[model samples]
Target: MEEILQLLSEDARLTDAQIAERTGISEAEAKDAVAKLEKDKVIRRYKTVIDWERAGIEHVFGFIEVRCAPERGVGFDAVAERIMEFPEVHSLYLMSGAYDFLVVIQGGNMRDVAYFVAEKLAPLDHVVGTATHFVLRRYKVDGDVMVERAQAKRLPVTP
Candidate 1:
């Protein structure tokens, strides 16, 4: 089961036969396992990572460190649920250290991201403060290197 999960995580495009062959299991068994995993909500969704720079699409990614007051009894759950409803919020995590929540957002430009922090996220109930950082470039994402290595160029030697 773990092997199947690992295989699927590495490459979502793998067929049941491919996974079964690699794991030394029957193809039908692999299919059953995957079906069970989906039913149990273990396998959330398959994803594709794209290079927006190469695609010529402009987007700004922002990481916001949020300081907030946790609600009584519910703690951060209530606040997290509220933040999740925003379309601009790509991801939100309850964090430790100086901040209570780390919010990842995407927008067309820096001003768009700034506006979300200043108007939407920061003004939320229980939200005390927020510090935003823009991602200049992504060298790696999800263990996959974003930058492709270039071939070394050598100058011609004079005889």
Candidate 2:
């Protein structure tokens, strides 16, 4: 099961037959395992990591450190759900240390992100404070390298 998951994680496009062949298991068994994983919500939706720069999409990304007072009984879950409802919030995580949540958001520009932070995020009930850090560049994301470092061009040394 672990091997099947590992293979799928590496390449989501692999068919059940391919996975079974790779793991030396029967196709039916592989299919059953995969179906069980999906049914149990162990296998989330498959995702495609895109290089937005290559796609020529102009956008700004920001990581917002949010400090909020947790709601009684519900804790951070309630606040998290409210924050997640916004389309600009790509990802939200309940974090440790000084911040309560680490929110990843995207917008057209700095102003758009700032507006979202000021008008949308900051005004939310129980939201005490926030620190927004704009992403200047992305070297890598989700285990995929976004940018390739250039090789140095130099003459060969001879003795």
Candidate 3:
């Protein structure tokens, strides 16, 4: 299972036959293992990581640190749910600090981002205030270079 998972993590697009061939398992066993992993919620999702900026997204992406009221009982989760519903929000996390949540958002310009904050996020019930800082640049992403290097290494097997 660990070997199968390693192969999938390196590239989830591998066929059962390929996985089995690499992992030294029968093709049918590879299929069953993948199915069971999905059923057991071990493999929750397979997602594509896109370079949105290179894909012609011109504006800056920013992280907003929000201070919200804990009186809402569910704390930041309720507010986060509302925030995530917006298309502009790429990601949100409940943080442990002076701020309750960290939100990642993207927009075409500063004006668009401002509007999203003022019109949508700020209006949420427990939200107190928000501090936003735009990302100037990204040196690395999702450890792509590391993954590419790992992929380049030949799998150890007697084929």
Candidate 4:
């Protein structure tokens, strides 16, 4: 299962036959494992990460700290749903502490973000406040580094 996950994580394009051949498992078994992984929500979904600059999207990505009134129920959930419905929102999370939620937003420029804050988010009845912080650059993502360090640690010499 670990190998299956690792292989899929490396590249989700691999077929069951390929995974089976590499893992020395039967194709049927490999397929079944993948099915179970999905059914159990282990493998939730596959997504492609695009390079914003290369994609020609002149948009900036940022994290928004949402301080909302958590009265009860989906107070946060409802607000998050509304935020996620916007094309500008990439991700949303119900958080703890000072902020009730965290939002990932993309926009054409500062004006776009400001417009969203003023016209959309701030106007929501449940919304208490929001703080936007722009991301200058991404150094690393999903533990996959731009510069991979060589496996330099020496292994024990065995006769």
Which candidate has the highest lDDT of all?
A: 2
TM-scores of all predicted structures: 0.88, 0.84, 0.77, 0.77
Per-residue lDDT of 62 in model 1? 85
RMSD of each: 5.1, 4.8, 5.0, 3.8
TM-score of 2: 0.84
Residues 66-129 of candidate 2 have per-residue lDDT tens digits of 9999889999999999999999999999988988999999757788889999999999999999
Q: In model 3, what is the error at residue 32, expressed in angstroms?
A: 1.0
* Tens digit of per-residue lDDT, candidate 1, span 33-131: 999999999999999777888888888888999999988899999999999899999999988798999999875888888888888989998999999
> How much lDDT does each candidate structure score?
0.90, 0.91, 0.82, 0.84
Query: Per-residue lDDT for 1-159 in model 4, tens only?
Result: 999999999888899999999999999999999999999999999976666665677768888898888658755667777778888887888886889888888757878988887898878778889998988876675765544378878669956
TM-score, structure 4 vs. true:
0.77
TM-score for candidate 3: 0.77
Runs off by more than 4 Å, candidate 1: 150-159
Per-residue lDDT, model 2, residue 94, is: 91
Worst 10 residues of 4 by lDDT: 139-148
Clashes counted in candidate 2 amount to 0
Rank the models by TM-score, top first.
Answer: 1, 2, 3, 4
Which pairs clash inside model 2? Answer: none
Candidate 3 segments whose C-alpha is farther than 4 A from its true place? 106-110, 146-159
Better of 1 and 4 by TM-score: 1
* Deviation in Å, model 2, residue 84 alpha carbon: 1.4
